[model samples]
Target chain A: MPLPAPSPNPNPAPPDAGMSRRSFLRTSAVLTTGLAALAASLKPLLEMNDFPTMERFLQKYYKEMTPEDMEKVLKRIEAEVEKQYGIRPHVRDLKPMDGVEFVYCLNLTRCIGCRKCVHACVAENNQSRNPEIQYIRVLRLPHGSLDIEKAEHNYAPESVPEKGYFYMPVQCQQCKNPPCVKVCPIHATWQETDGITVIDYDWCIGCRYCEAACPYWARRFNFTKPSIPKERLNPDMAYLGNRPRRQGVMEKCHFCIQRTRVGRYPACLEVCPTGARKFGNILDPNSEVSYILKNKRVFIQLKEELGTSPRFFYYFDV
Target chain B: MLRLVLCTQPRSSLVAFGGSARMRPVEGDALTRAGDPMNSQTRTTLVLTGLILAFLALTTLFISNLPGRPLRQPPIPLVNTNFLDTATVRRSYADLVRAGEDLSDFDCYACHEKGKPPPLRYDTNQNLIVPKEHSDIVMGHGSHGRNNNCFNCHNETNLELLQTRDGHEVKFADSPSLCGSCHGPTYRDWEAGAHGRISGFWDRSLGAAERKACVNCHNPHSPHFPSRPPAPGPHPLRPVATASVEPGPNH
Candidate 1:
């Protein structure tokens, strides 16, 4: 007997023809539920890895910020200093002095290698802790001997040059014609109108040409990044004088230009216990240096032959 | 169409019989061949097997011998390594101008040339440049048999015609500190006020810590100490003889 014609159903059952429809529906429901639960659990995992928030917390350079941006930076700097150093700092904005001339005069006969001037200078200038970066050097020489050879400057504690040696402190002479200014490759160093030579730390490329050009041995190059642990740092930093310096750049005694130009004496002059240093305007005929030059009979200048025309002058008791 | 060719092939009978399956197919024998289902199926299987084996062999050879093929290396990028070049020296000159420093006409190279100035000639005499006499005491040069030279104090950059910040040019090194290297004793004395000559009268108000450099006292080129003049004859004599006899009468 011929089988009854099969129903010509255009849409036949799915490939699981042997399984009941309920079984197929149950399998699909379990898969859908599992996928939904997995998606819900992954949402919090993705939120935990927020990268943008981390990038906003880092500090940046001063030139890269605007006035509005700097307020936030200043606040951050204040917070960091408090957290790291346990001290509050007073930050200020300072500018170079205009229309003033600063000159330094050294009395070689009187300097007594006490190194108080050196220490005072370091403190005033906010210098690095390394002893090698000292701005002032007190040399001891033999008495009654004009010969530089007989001079013994390497004195130990009780360093007063033996019975015959005299002391002299050498520093930046604030030359009217500074060779260092001429040699700087980047205009990062310049003599201010006030006669104090200054440097722009940010602008300096650390080529050390200025150090090579200075005649007074007044300039020093920072070989490594300065370390002034935030607590020891003097926050009343001068723009051209004593803000913590960078590595590989040249620096010199600015005659305490920041303080002096503000109508105050340099730290060395203020703290000198022996009154060996004299600071005044050479241009003013009535200034103390001018009076000293006029009244002193035993006055002399170092390397007068080199013609550097240094403002520093010396005198001794006859 | 492919089935018809396989069925017509003489290899179809060889495939069905196993050992004789290597025979080549001949054209124009479709109907009788198709009647034998087993032979057609065997022929089709053999052809498919041969194609797959050829493809795999090619893939294996290509992967194994890849290391023997030549490689192309990328080119190096350019950089500004000319830090000490003439252009840099010239830029230094520009920097001086911006800083407002004056440039003297004295170019360091003019006097410091290798063959022209004569090696080891610091002064006009052409004698080996000697350290200042005091450098011995200050720098311990006496211990070294005076081995140090002007180059020791005045470091040489070995570059010619270095540029200044003002577009003018000068030497690469400065004078005072260069001189200080060998003249350490003198330099220290100058700093401490012991070595160099002092100018001006002493005052109680001005401190002794402010001393001048050695260059301020004796010249580096002709460092001669001025001889002290003899004391005047009318100076006070200590322990003078008293008129003892006349004093006794007055008492």
Candidate 2:
């Protein structure tokens, strides 16, 4: 009887195996709810206004781009900057000049900690105003001490060169063996031929490895979309220099690459009331930097024990 | 897989409920135990559905609380931070010369009689009393009033010319060399392009470098740099009001 009942069905459905209408409804409800939850979780990404366009997403790495590619990129950047800030910027990709290596010499004896350089840099470079980004941090330290840990970073007194204190303005050292460049997961930042450690803002993933790796605390991250006043926008821009940065890219002092490459003094150097900041071509023997290195009492590089070999030299006139 | 897990969860929990149901005289067991109006599987499904709904609600609440775009505020005003003291006597002289300004404005003899230099007057304290005509000048040139006399730099024989310590006549434009007469080291540093501000090109082939004169930064009457309020410091994302400098043992 069992043999007769077993028909030649290779795939047999048991009595209770078929899907009921209730079960089907249950499964569909679960599926719909799960899909709704997934959609809800992605709301933030959908609301983002700064999501990259197809062109920006597909743009080549900075070093890999040809001159024609750079030209197009610069033009695109100009258009983007204009659209965002309501001013058409004169953006150019200035190359490091031949027979030039920039070196900065800061006379510690003369720095009054007026912080004019910091503001000048902010005006020159289009740093964010709200949640402000300043390149130079003037540390007010007690006299007869060289320890940076004991330095006051946020000291806002009535006047600078306060009694029993000295000022040291610290920015990017432009290290020859840069730890920031080495630690970047993507090679978004690297040292140029002219000793400027430049970052390709477009290629950066905002991981902030370079920022963390920097010994000088020079690197800054744009956590939000930079809010710059349209009227205050600096039109003279360089691709890897003072060009307005996007949210989540790293930026630091490039020795005012745009000005330095075009044979103009940096805004910071020009704005120093005490004439403390000195910058020149280290390659030229007759340059001011070379003279200071030879004649002035130049001390060890900032955090030289880390072997960063910073191009910035601190000197004493005594 | 979710259904399988959901169905399995209530069996153990239902067993615990069953014990309590049985303890109830008869109505509790009839309502919730094995043979009831609503079966255990249906009851478990309802419980899980309610749970999923609650979880989704909480998740939605959490997502809404996440940080969004910052509220647009009025733009922060830009400040004039170029604090270089470029409005001194030399700056005015340089500006006049560059503009090809009338020489009579600067010519001392235009006010004073020909071949007559103004007599130097001193207060009872022996401090040089600046005349009413040159009341704008505040003389504090050298330490301890050593170089306060007008005849030190200004020539008495000729009102227009200035004489260096070596008796060399120096024009106002070449006053850096005149300052070199006393401040030899500073002048040397300035000549070598180390001292003072040097604008324009560092590479000589590209452009001419403009070295600022001594009086461009320093006031001839008072050479000491006057202290002023510093520019505002960094505005960090997080407001940290704590003092950064802790008096450590090393300091």
Candidate 3:
């Protein structure tokens, strides 16, 4: 090159000595290095998907949320679910009924292995359309045997009542010493003053601890998102009973706490054709249940060995 | 002289500048010699001082937060016997009478096992029909053995029977309390959410809805009573079979 440019002075003056090219290069280099380091450090944090935090921000627990907050949260949840599942879910608040109580009686003698209650419960509770997740199970057992291995529920319609077969509908026994309540780690489930056990859906961590402790096999977990369409959803919902549930929480029969406590009968009880299901206040003397107990004999319950002390009872004419 | 040049830079450099060089030795030489020991001693002292200060601070914090005195146990409320008094029991009996109910047939032992007639007479009135010896008849009821009796459930209510407006005799109270008499364990369980009906609802604000009673699910008299079947489902009609053993042989 034309007489190599005079060797530039190595030491550059400060910025105060008029803007210089050397100073420009030094400042730009420092700035570039700092930006690179910052971008590298922040990459991992920015990439992380905080759906749970987003969900919390979008919707708060019913207890923590005000009425206005709940309305906004409900709409947000409905929208979020629609985006995820391609279906909008209807969410409502289910409050406990006043004064009324619900009880269930199963006639082991008359049941003919008909699973009407199971289907009825699914429809009533708005459960997902999965065969394994039924609330009620009508067990087909031998007439004189109590062994669970001897029981079978896999019968075709024509195979029902084949010779000496009897039907036993096993549901949540609602034990006086409910083992499920004792095993919950987070206190997500508890007994109400009205003698019903309930679960807090949000507090549940999906650990499935209560599911193992229940003797009645009455509890069911939501493996996948529930699929009730927004338009078809039942607007009336209860905190402990038939509100739509999320994926991975333990739920069971509350004896229709929402219905019975409000002077209404449970769906299963209402549908039983033989009038086999009876519910009332054990406190009331004139109720029909009291009269029957006075008149009838030969009543029994399942698994008295575990000392669960279930509220449900069964009797036969003998 | 040749040796002297090498020696001059070495040995002579020290001696040539005697006092000034000696002063340098006093300054630089002594500092170099004592540097490691002084540094080590200072480090050890600093570490020990810090540890002691930290421990003292922690102990002071703990002691300052401790309670001044031991906690005292709470006082227990005195038990009242007014409800159990004989006079109160008489007044309750009078109230039952005013309700048009008879007082003679309402004793605890009357319908219970020890009574001449069990409190709830379904068929025949036999003394001690369900004998106290046969107390272990049901699940939760039998757990307390014979030590528990009707008063456990009847509580302070007078056992005197009363006649209803319809000219029917009945207990002063209702079933749950009446049954709760001897079955104290189950009664407590029921009161605290153990042995009773539990119903769920979908809608809560529609006023009143039809609900089942405890007796509807349980039979208090029998204890472990089974629920009856729903009204029977519709059955398929069957063809009539006619008797037709031809009279051909007779003709």
- Top candidate by lDDT: 2
Instruction: Looking only at chain A, give the TM-score of model 1 against the true structure.
Output: 0.70
Chain A superposition TM-score per model: 0.70, 0.89, 0.71
TM-score for each candidate, following the candidate numbering: 0.42, 0.83, 0.45
Off by over 4 Å in 3: A1-101, A159-161, A228-233, B1-251
In angstroms, how far off is A54's CA in candidate 2?
2.8
iRMSD computed for candidate 1: 30.6
Better of 1 and 2 by lDDT: 2
True contacts kept of 2: 0.42
Q: What's the lDDT for all of these models?
A: 0.51, 0.79, 0.52
RMSD of each: 28.9, 6.7, 27.0
Encode model 2's per-residue lDDT on A1-318: one tens digit a residue.
Answer: 355664453323454544654445455656766777787778768768897888889999999999999989998999999889889999989899888899999999888898888888888898888768889999988878788878887888898767778889999999999999999999999999999999989999999999999999999999888878887789999999999898888999999988999988888888786778899989999999999999888985889999999999998877
Please write out the lDDT profile of model 1 over residues B53-151, one tens digit for every residue.
554454444444455443432422211212111111022333454567775423455545654533453445433554443244332233333533543
Model 1 chain A — which ten-residue stretch has the worst lDDT?
Answer: A47-56
Residue A278 CA error for candidate 3 (Å)?
A: 2.0
Stretches off by above 4 angstroms in model 2 are A1-37, B11-54, B66-75, B81-92, B101-105, B242-251
